[model samples]
Target chain A: MATAKDRAQAKAGSGLNDDIGEQKRLELYRTQVVLREAEQRAYDLFLQNLVKGTSHLSLGQEAVAAGFAGAMKPGDLSFCTYRGHAHTLARGVPVEKVLGELMQRDNGLMRGKGGSMHLTSVDHGVMGSYAIIGAHLPIACGAAWRAQYKGDKDVSVCFFGDGTTNIGAFHEALNFAAVWKLPVIFVCENNLYMEYTPIGDVTAVPQPAADRASAYGLERILIDGNDADVVYRAAQIAFDKARAGEGPSLIECLTYRQSGHSRADPAKYRPEGELDRWKLRDPIKIYRERLLQFGVAERVIADIDAQVRKVVDDATEACKAAPPPPLDIIATDVYADGGWAWRN
Target chain B: MAELTYRDAVIRGIAQEMSRDPDVVFLGEDVAKAGGVFKATVGLYEQFGPLRVRDTPISEQAILGAAMGAAMTGLKPIAEIMFSDFFAVCFDYIANEFPKSRYMSNGQVKCPLVVRTGNGAGSRFGAQHSQSVENWCMMIPGLKVVAPSNPRDVIGLLAASVRDPDPVIFLEHKSLYPTKGEVPDGEIVDTLGTAKVLRSGKDATICALALMVPRALEAAEKLKAKHGIDCEVVDVRSLVPLDTQTILGSVARTHRLFTVEENPRLCGWGAEIVSIVADEAFYDLDGPPVRITTPHIPLPAADILEDIVLPTPDRIAETVRRSLQS
Candidate 1:
C-alpha cells in the first residue's frame, strides 16, 4: 500500500505546485516556525513551574495569531477570548506582561485585576480579552463603529473559539458587524472543541465556521490554520479589504490544541489517534523542514532561538523582580478621571 | 445673557456642546425628526446631521450599551432614556461596566458618558411613566448625578455635566421644564458639585433636588409669611460629589434639617442626604432630620391621586414646621 505523501510524489513532482511568491510566502512560513518555537518554549516554562490557569497553547492554532498580528498596523484594535495569551503576545503585548498577568501581578495587563480571562491594553489597541465568551464581540462592534463615526482608519479583530460559534452574541455581533460594514475581522480558531465538548456536537452548521459568515454577508475564508503562509495571505487580503470600506470577514482557521484545556484535564476525549495525527502537521516542524530545504543554515536557526530565549528570560526576571501595584491603585481610574471612584 | 426657560436652557446647552465637539453625539428615541418628546433636542438633527444626532433602537439596554462603548472609545455621548423609569433596563450596564471599566482598566480609560433622563410624578402619566428614580443611580460608584431645577441652574448644570470627566446621570424634571426663569447664556459655566443656597433664612434649612426645589421654595415662602418660620431653601444640585460642606454648614447654622423629594420615602435621594447630615452633623442638630417625600406607591394615573401620592408644597411646609416645633 502506497502512503499518501509517497503516491502524490509518484504522480507528479511539480504539477501540484506551491502557488505563492518566493520571498513573502517564505518569510511568513518562516514566522510560523518562530512562533511555534516561541510558544513551545512558553509551554516548557509552564510545565516547569506547573503554572496556574489554562494556557490555550497555539500549537496548531499559531497561524491565526501570526497571520493577523503580522499584518496588523498601528492603531488597529483586537480583542480575544480567555485563551488569548497567543493573541495578546501576537499583538506585541510583552510576553513578560502576559505571563505576569497570568500570574496575577499588578504590573501585568489589567493590573492583575483581569487574570487569565481579561487581558487588555488600550494603548496597543489590544482592547480586551474577556473570560465571558461572547461579551467582547459587542465591545468590538461598538469600538469599530465609533471609529467609523470619527472617520478614523482603524480596523478591529475579534477572536473566538470554535465553541463560541453557537453563542447568540456571535450571531448578533456578526449581523451587526455586517449591517454597519464595521472594520472588524471575526477570526475563529476552530480547534474542534468548545472546551471538552466537540464542536460538531454543539454547532448545527460546520466547516470554515465561515460557512455561517455568508448568512451575515461578510467575506469568509477557510484556510489551513497550521500553515502560517496561507493564514497570513488570507488575513492580509481581508485586512486591506476592510480598511478600504468593505465590511467584516469571518476567517475560520482549522487547527487543534496540543495541551489540556487550561492547567486542568488530560484532553483524553481528543480522540485516540487525533493528537499524533495532528502532530504531523506541527507548524514549527514544517517551517524548519522548509527552511532547511531552502538552504537556510541550522546555525541561523540556533541564533534566532538563542535570541528569543534571552529576551524571554530577561522579561521573566524583570517581571519577577517588579513590585505589584499598590492597594490605593484599586480606588483609582474608575471613571477615567477625578475622585469619582468610590469617593463620589 | 438671554432669559430662558428651563427647557430652552438645556436645549441651548446641548446645541452648543454638540456644535463645538464633533464627538459629542446624541441618541434617544423620537429625538431625531420628532426632536424629542420634550423638544429638548429640537433643531439638533438639522444642525449636527443624522449621524451625530442619532435615533437609536427602542431598546434602552442597547442604547446604553452602545453609549458605554461610544464613550469608552472617545466619543462624548449623551444618551436619553425618555423617562427615568426606562433606566431600570440599563442599571446593570451603568452599575457594572460604565462604573467599573475605568477601574478594571487601571485608569487607562474613562467612560465620559451622560445619561440624560428625568424623574418626578407630575404628568399623571401613570406608574410606568412617572417614576423619579434618580436616587437609584446613586447606588453605583463612578457616576455623577445632577438634578437641576430652574432655567439658570439647568443651563449651568448641563454645561458642567457635559464637560465632567466621569459618567454623569443628568436628571431634568419634566414638571419644571415649562417654568420660566432668568437663565444666563454667557461665557460662564456654572460650578459643578455645589449646592445653591437659593433662599437664605434662619429657622431651618430645606434641602431639595430638581422639581422638589421649586416646591421647597414655595414652602419656604409660605413658612416665612404664614408660620413666622425663616426657612432656608438649598437646591442640592449635584446629588453625587454632593456639596456636603454647604449642607453641613447650613444644618450647623440653622440647627434643623428637612428634605423634600418626589421619589418615594424609602431609599430616596433625600434619605441619603438626611443620612449624611445625621452622621456628620448629629451634634449640631437642634431637632431630628425630617423627610417630606412621596408615599411608597407608584404615581397614580388620576391627577388627584397623583398629587396625593407625591409631596406638594403644603406637605413640605408642614414637614418643616413640624421639624421646627418638635
Candidate 2:
C-alpha cells in the first residue's frame, strides 16, 4: 500500500522535490530523534526530582521546531514560547546546556537564571523563550524592524501556541509587523489544546492564526506540522519571502502534544483515545519510515537513533554532576551595570 | 545661556542624542508628523527623517515591545507612551519584560531603551490623561526613573537617560512644557541618581520632583518672607537610583523635612523619602516630617476642583508655617 510519504515523494514538480536532498532529509530525521530523546530524558529527570520547578515540554511537537530551526540561516533570530526545549536543541544549543538549565546548575545556558521557560542563547540566534503567551510576537517584530532599519538580510522567526492568538498583543504585533513590512514569520503551532482546553472552544474562528492573516494583509498559510518535510518547506518559503522584503507571513502548523501540557498536568481533560490516536502518527515514527523509502539504509537510521540516545545520556550525567548556581548569583544581572542598586 | 521652554528642551535633548548616535531611534503615536500630543517633540521628524523618527499605531504593547526588541539587538530606542496613565495599558512590558529581561537572562540580553511619557496633572485632561505616576515606575526594581522640572535639567537629564545602558522611564510634566528657564549653550549632559539643591537654607528641607519642584521653590520664598522659616529646596531628578544622600544631607542641616508632591497621598514618592529619612536620619529631625500632597482621590476635570486638589505654593507655605509653629 502506498503511504502518504510515498505520494508526497512521487509528486515530481511539488516543493517537496526541491533542494531538501537525502542529506537534509537525514538531518531532519536526526533532529527529531534528538529532540524526542532529550525531551524523554527531561521527563525522566523531572520524575527523579533532578529538574526543579515547572516545565512545559514539546514531546510530540518536535517536527515544527526541527523543521523551522533547520530551515533557518546562521543569523536568523528565533523567538519561541515556554514549550521550547525542542526549539533550543534544534538551534544547535548544546543539550547539556539546556539540561543543565533545567537542572538549575552552574553550567546552564543562563547559569541557572532563566530556567526552562526563558531559554536564551544569542550566540545560537534563539532570541528568547517567552513564558508570557503573546508578548514575544511584537518583540520579534522589533528585531525584524531592526534588521529592516539596518538593511540586514536576517529574518526573525517567532513561534507561539494557538492560545496566543486570543491575546491582545498578538493582534497588535501582527498589525504592526505587517504595516512596517517587517522581515518576520509568525509561526503558530496549533497543538489543538491551549493548555487543558481545546483551541477551537475559545477561538472565534476555526483556524485562529490563518483566518486572521487577511486582517494584517498577510497571506494565509496552514500546513501539516506533524510532517517534518512539510514544515521545512513552508519555513524555507516564508524565510525567503521575508528576506525578499515581501513583509511578514503567518503560518499555522497543525500538530499535537503527546504528553500533558506540563509535568504537573495529567491531561485528564482530554477526550478518550485522543492521545492514543495521535501516537500512531508520531513525528519521529513518520520521519523514520520516510527515510527508509528514500533508500537510506536501515543501519544508518539505527546509528542515528543510537547517537541520539548517547547524546541524551551524556547530557543527563553532566546535568546530575553539575552544581547549583552560587548564592552570589541571586543579586547579580538586575541591570546593565551588573548591580541591583536602585538607590545610593 | 539661552532661554528655552521645557518643551523645546525636550526637543533639544532628543535631537542631541539622535544626532550624536546613529543607533538612537525615536517612535510613538503621532510623534512624527503630528509632533507628539504635547508638542514636546516638534521638530524630531523633520530633523531625523521618517526611518529613524518613525510613527506607530495606538498599540502601546507593540510600541514598547518593539522598543525592547530593538534595544536588545543593537539600536537605542526612545518610545513615547503619550501619557503616564497609559502605563496601565502596557505595564507588562514595563513591569515584567524590560526590567526582568536582564535579570532573568542573567545579563545575556540588555534593554538599552527609554520610555518617555507625558506625566502629572495641570492641563485639565482629567483623571485618565493627567496623572503623576512616577511612583508606578519607582517600585519596579530594574527600571531607572527620571522627572525633570526645569528646561536645563530636561536637556541634561534626558541626554543622560539616552546614554544609560539600562531601561529608563523619562517622565516629562505636561504642565511645565510652556514654562521657560535658562539652558546653557553647547552640548549639555547630566548624570542620573543625582539631586540638585536649588536653594540652601538652615531651618527646613523641602524635597520635590517635576512640577512640584517649582512649587516648592515658590513656597520656600513665601515661607522666608511670611514666617521667617528658611527652607532648602531639592529637585529629586531621579527616583529609582534615588539621591538619598543629597536629601538626607539637606535634612541633616535643616533639622526639619517636608516633601511637596503632586501625586496622591497614598504611597506617593514622598512617602518613600519619608520612610528613608526616618530609617537613616532619625537623629537629625527636630520635628515630625510632613508631606504636602493631593488628597487620595481621583483628579477631577473642573478647574476649581483640580486647582484645589493639586499642591499649590500657598498651601505648601501654609503647611510648613503651621507645622513649624506648632
Candidate 3:
C-alpha cells in the first residue's frame, strides 16, 4: 500500500523534478538532522540541570524553520518566537554558541545575558527571538520598513505560531505592512497548540493566515508544514514577491509539535494516540526515507548522521566546560552608553 | 539665532538630523501629507520624500514597535504618537520591547529611537487626550524622558535625542507649538539628563518641567517683587537621569525646594523629585519640600473648570509664600 509520503512526493515531485536534486535533498536532510540532534541534546542538558530556565523545543516543527530560514538572503532578517532553537540554528548559528548561550556561559551568543528564549545573532541577520508571543510581528515589519526606506532588496521573514494570529499586534503588523507594501514575509508555523490549549479552542477563525491576512489585502498561502519542499517553494514565491516590491505575504505551515510546549510542561492534555500518530509522520524519518528514494547512497546518509552526532556531542561538552559570565559585567549591557543600572 | 515657532523648531531639528544622517527616518499617522496634528513635523515629508517621511496607520503599537525594530537595524527612527494619552494603547512596546531589547541582546543591538508626542492639557481635548503621563515612563529604567518648554530647547533636545544611543520619549506640549521664540539655526545639541536654571535667586529653589517652567518663572517674578522672596527656577528638562548635582547645588544655595507640574499630585514626577531631595539632599534643605500639582482628578473639557484644576502662577506664588513662611 502506498503511504501518504509516497502520494505527496508523487503529486509534489512529479515530472517537475526541477524541485531539488539529490545534492540539495541530502543538504536539507543533513540540516534537519543536525537541528533535531542539537535540540535533543539541549533537552538532555536541561534535564541534567545545566541549562537554566525553561526551553521551548521545536521537536517536530523543524521543516518550517529549515525551509524558511534557509531560503532567506544573507542580508535579510529573520525574527522568531520563544520556540526558536531550530530557527536560530537553521540561520547558521554555530552549535557550540547556541549550546553555550543555553547554558548562560561567558562565550554565549549574547554574552550569557540572553538564554534559550532570547537567542539572537545580528551578524547572521537573526534578529533577537522574543519571549512575548506576536510581539515580534511589528518589529519584523519595522526591519522590512527600514529595507524599503533604504531601497534595499533585502526581505525580512517573521516566524510565529498559530497562537500569535489572535493577538492585536498580529493584526496591526499585517495592516501596516500591507499599507506600506513593505518587503516582509510572515510565516505562521501552526503546530496545533498555543502552549497547552488547542489552537482551534483559542483562535476565532479556522484558517488563521488566510482569514487574517486577506483582510489586510496581503497575499496568503497555506501549505503542508511537514513537507520541507512544500514550505521551501511557498517561501521562495513569497520572497520573490517581496523582493519585486509586491509587499508582504503570509504562508501558514500546518505542522505539529511532537514535544510539550516547554521543558516543564508534560502535555498530558494531548488526546490518546496523538503522539504515536505524529511520530509515524516525523519530519526527519519521512525526509530520510525520501532522500534514500531520491538515489542518495546509504553511506552518505550514515556519514551525515555521524557528523551531526559528533557536532552536538562536542558542542554540548564545550558548553558544559565553559564558565558563567562575570559578576562585575552584570550591569554593563543594560544600556548602550552604560549609564542605566539596576538600583536597589 | 533665528526666530522660529516651537512647531518649526521641531521640524528643523528633525530635518537637520535627517539631512546629516541617512539612517534617520520619520513615521507616524498624519506625519507625511498631513504634516502632523500639531504641525511639528510640517515640511518634512516634502523635504525627505515618502520613503524617509512615512505616514503610518493609526496603530500606536505598530508605530512604536517599528521604531524599536528600525532603530535596532541601523536606523534612527523618530515616531510620533499623536497624543501622550494614546501611549496607554502601546505601553507594552515602550515598557517592554524598546527598552529591554538592548539589554536582552547583551548590548549587541542599539535602539536609537525617539517617540515624539504632543502632551499637556490646555487644548480642552478632555480626559482621554489630556493626561500628562510622562511620569508613568520615568519609572522604567532603560528609557530617557525629556520635555522641552521653548523653541530653543526643543531644537537642542530633539537633536540630542536623535543622536542618543538609546530610546528617548520626547514630549512637546500642545500649547507651546505655535508659540514663537528665538532658536539657533546652527547645531544646538544639548546633553541628555541635564537641567537648566532658568532664573537665579537666593531664597527658594523652584523646579518645574514642560509648560510649568514658564509659569514657574512668572511665579518667581511675583514672589520677588510682591513678597520680597527671591526664588530660583530650575527647568528639569530631562527626567530619567535626574540631574542630582545641579538640583542639589540649587537647593544648597537657596535652602528651600519646591516642585511644580500639571499632572496629578499622587505619584507624579514631583513626587519623585521630592523623594530624591529627601533622600540625598535632606541636610541641605532648610524647610520641608513642597509640590504644587493638579489635584487627583481627570481633566475637564471646560476651560474655566480646567483652569482651576491645573496649577497656575497664582497658585505657585501662594505655595512659594506659604513654604517661605515655614
Question: Against the true structure, whose DockQ is highest?
Answer: 2
Docking quality level of the chain pair in candidate 1 = acceptable
Could you give candidate 2's per-residue lDDT for residues B89-133 as a string of tens digits? 899999989999998888888999999999999888899988899
Candidate 3's TM-score on the B chain: 0.98
* Root-mean-square deviation of candidate 1: 5.2
Give lDDT: candidate 3, residue B12. 89
TM per candidate:
0.83, 0.97, 0.96
Pull out the clashing pairs in model 3.
Answer: none
Q: Which should have the higher TM-score, number 2 or number 3?
A: 2
- Backbone clash pairs for candidate 1 read A54-A262
10 residues in a row with least lDDT, candidate 3 chain A: A9-18
Which has the higher TM-score value, candidate number 1 or candidate number 3?
A: 3
Model 1: per-residue Cα lDDT over B1-326, one tens digit each: 66787878778888878877788988788888888898888888898898888776565655675677677788888889999998776665667667766666667666888889866778989999988888788877878888898888777777788787788899889888788887554644787779989999888989998888888999989988898999888998887778888988898889888888788878887788888888988999888888888888867899989988788888888877876776
Give the residue spans of candidate 1 off by over 4 A.
A1-60, A131-133, A161-176, A190-226, A252-306, A335-344, B1-5, B59-62, B65-69, B83-92, B118-120, B123-129, B264-267, B294-306
Q: Interface Cα RMSD for all candidates?
A: 2.7, 0.7, 2.5
Per-residue CA lDDT of candidate 1, range A253-319, in tens?
7778877777645788888998999889776665566556666678876666666677677766766
Candidate 1 displacement at residue B200 in angstroms? 2.0
What is the C-alpha local distance difference test score of each model?
A: 0.75, 0.91, 0.86
Which candidate ranks first by TM-score, i.e. highest?
A: 2
